[model samples]
Target: MSMNVSEFVWKRLQEWGLHRVYGYPGDGVGGLDVALEKAQGSDGSGMEYVQVRHEEMAAFMASAHAKFAGGVGLCYATSGPGAIHLLNGLYDAKMDNQPVVAIVGQQARTALGAHYQQEVDLVSLFKDVASDYVAIGTVPSQVRHMVDRAVRIAQNKRSVTCIILPNDLQLMAYEDPPLVHGTTHTGVGFPAESKLPEQEGLQAAANVLNEGKKIAILVGAGCLHATDEVIAVADKLGAGIAKALLGKAAVPDDLPYVTGGLGLLGTKPSWDLMQDCDTLLMVGTSFPYSEFLPKPGTARGVQIDIKGDKLSLRYPTEVNLLGDSAVTLKALLPLLEQKTDTSWRNTIKSNVEDWWKVLEERAMHSAEPINPQRVFWELSPRLPENCIVTADSGSVANWYGRDLKFRRGMMGSLSGSLASLGAATPYAVAAKMAYPERVVIGTIGDGAMQMNGMNVMITISKYWKQWSNPHLIIMVLNNRDLNQVTWEERVQLGEGKTESTQSIPDFPYAKYAELIGLKGIFCNDPDKVGAAWDEALGADRPVILEFYTDPNVPPLPPHITLKDAKNFMTMIPDEPELGSVLKNSAKELLSTVLPGR
Candidate 1:
């Protein structure tokens, strides 16, 4: 069998160390599909192709794969709509700074300008999202460099890149670029280099950190691999550590000085730490909310990041150390004076203890059916050792941020900057694919579950048996309302919940799981939330754990500003679930001070 353009493309990707691809099939990619079939063979002995129900899900899975597996994620799609479907997930990768390469099928070269069937200008469509690099293959010779550059750029820049393959060109006879002036040649592989800040810059940062009596450390996804370094520096400075949502797993929640997540979906301890700190050490995190940080001139700042452009972006830093998170922290650690006065650290630990108790009270508070927080609160202690978890956007993210305790060895991520709904399911699927030995779990709101999570369950159903440990669980908060947006309208826009927009039709999520050959468990009882998780964790196959939750229970912010309070109060008169909303809010708020209740 002679090599074709499609064959060479896959071969090159394999050489570059990408062994898996998440994608959906279409006629536009018929040649590639044929080539993939030949490559995988009857024994399934080649590139792993995850056939996602939708192209969008494929891109999301690719993004998750990159995050969990620490490699360049790859996804494929057909022409027009399929190519367009990849944008949302690709944008998710771009915003979150994950490396993902998308190989999209395009209309034939002759039909491209003619606007023939399924004809779309893919290059222009992908230009913005894949701003670093996007190219279309016009001939078989161009395919080589296109693959090499796309993978290399995506990996090195930690951004999305695209290679558009026209249908006609995909089936063409493969050929190396001729040794002529007009032709180009390319090779595979991105070599690793030790990235470190200069000693002078490290010393400057240490000086700022050393001068302050109270210090706060904020870590994001960039610090995932630098957990030890982060802990060491925080201990040295006697600082309290706060995590950005994307950095939930960067440091274990068990540490007394680790104040959980920051921002709207953060902890009160974290809020208080930032408000009081005299110094801020930001490591590999471009956590967007500047308000959650120390007020300007209140704290001296030192930021360390690999990307020079991202340095001092969120806060004004006295020293912007440009280097890898682990490398920079290691160098800076030696110059830092170990704090002998443990007063600041003790205060932070006390605050963290009080915050956790408050969370427990809130989670245990009574609701119409179940408090969504309780579901996660129960799962926190029950989370399987070394399990990988993913959460979707909406009210669920609030519980995901506050209630769950991430221990070391456990991995968790979601749509961070993008904050898109319908990402949890695909992320869990990809995590399972990458580490089949470990258990994976996904927490999704009903809104997100209906939008994309339910569909990705079918993908899970198709591949569950192949995994070594069949313990993937999808937990759906069946609130029958777009709860997050409803609360946002009340708190942010000062409007009542619009039934027309907020109410989503209730679906039998657990039943749907059973219908698809997976285990299903529904729990509306608060007492049974933990038991349901146990059942799901011990299931013989993938399971859908549905919790019939109360949507009226507000996902309160860590620190509600006076304006936010006023805005929320303004919506009370017209709010449809006025009684329940007011009651839940009161109970949640009182949980903080009402000791031993």
Candidate 2:
């Protein structure tokens, strides 16, 4: 019996254990819509078609689903703008190394160059973002190859794959029997040992650690798999441990030697320790911010990463070891000496504690209406024990990165240099879908949230609500402006000039939330923030809490010196004293407290 190509594609997806596909409906993908409808009505296999407001959110949701479920996440989109909207979210998945499969519908195959309505060259469009791209021209041969390869690439490399389907291809007749199976399928397994690192590189890394004194170890997202082994190595070497933002959950934050992260929003003691150490060892992290790194003359650095190309991209390194983080660490441990450096570890530990105390004191005393410290305090206690938090780029990133007290097992993700807005909501959706048992919360700036909030709400309505797993919460800090840019402007211009560019028009987020069938709460009084948060968490459905705040509220002080602030301040003719005030305030605060490192 012959069936349409769409039916075969649906069956393949079902065989892969894909229960849900997210995207807005369109004529270009009508065949797929019909096929999915039939499958849903007849099989009752729990496979669902989720209609979202935007394709980007679909991509985001898919990525989050993959991250949480430990499998490939699937998203669908029609040709032209629909496919283009998916680029940003797909890139996020690629950078984070999540397994995502994006099935993009194209215009008729015959109209490839004629520029038909909603026409697009998806192959070229997604080439840069996805690890693999396959255009399915035929039902059995092309669809089968593309589906299998897309799944493999997504699973093996932990990268995204794009499959382009022309509208005409979907309607093509196929004679092959439906290859259906009862058992659920997991993603592709790890490749064979041929791709493993050479033993010589591992031995060389061991030699460097064996000889170095006062070494510091930095971990990144890549170390997630080998976290235990990395911890063991840190224990053996008596090295102080620090993490990049994406690597927050790589190890427990409260470990004796674990200082905080290293970056602009990073803790002061972590930077101090990294700067002063004689030898620095980077494990599975490629930290991009060069400003925070030690000068080439100050310390000898060694980096171990799965990708050799990323070794010295940011800073100069004395040694570059290429291997899987866990595998490489395990190999190096046997050749290392268990050094006794209780005194050295204690010194760094004391410095970290002092820094924490200063931050804590400031947070306790802050009575400002839009106090970031108070917000952190309120949200921290309410977070789920095994919760995952996703922070978008902007002021919210700084607060979550610096202030959030991550318990031993919590996971978090942040947009690094790309710093794209609208990441938080999609990331949260994906995180919740991935770990249905755990809570996932998205903390986004008002400006950032508005950019992608609608699509996120639609995605939640379709998938999460249907599952009755209302574990997703969105906390929007509605300060009514782009505060990060405003701060930069204040540093560059006078306060008067900045005020002109910084004002943001207010939006009625509470009303929008209600219209979307999610809980909506508006918080103007600072005290109400805590109660609003409690209500949102306890709700049986998605909730959006919009807190109206003053845009002029000062953000957490950056980790720069007074002199640097003053020099930058001189450039702006109008706000000369503004820079001085920030610098002096930070200096005064630091001077009263014991210096770390």
Clashes of each: 0, 5
> After best superposition, candidate 1 residue 420: deviation in angstroms?
0.5
* TM value for model 1: 0.99
What digit string (tens of lDDT, one per residue) describes model 2 on residues 1-597?
A: 567888877777777777777777677787887888877756556566767788888887787676556678889888889889888888878877778899988888888789688887788888888845555564444576577678777876778898888888888875443556632233323355433467777677777787777778889888766778878998888888888888877887667678777886677777877787877889888788777777776767778887766888777887787777887788778888888767767778887777666665555442335455556667876777888888888878777876677776788886554567888887787677566777788888888876777667766766775443676788888877786777665553434335555566688787788897887888877777788889888988778888776554445443666654664456456652355445544543554364431
Residue clash pairs of candidate 2? 64-430, 68-434, 69-434, 494-574, 494-575
The per-model lDDT (C-alpha) reads 0.92, 0.73
Which RMSD does model 2 reach against the true structure?
4.5
**Model 1: residues with Cα > 4 Å off, grouped in runs:** none
Per-residue CA lDDT of model 1 for 1-597, tens digit only, reads 579999988888988999899999888898899898877757876788989999999999999999999999999999999999999999999999999999999888888789699898888999999999999999888889999999999998999999999988999999998999998888777968558978888888888999999999999999999999999999999999999999999999999999999999999999999999999999989899999999999999999888888998989998998889998898888899999999999999999998999999999999979999999999999988999999999989999999999999999999999999899999999999999999999999999999988889998999999999999999999999999999999999888899999999999999999999999999999999888999999999999999999998889998888999999989988898899999999998888768348
TM-score against truth, every candidate: 0.99, 0.88
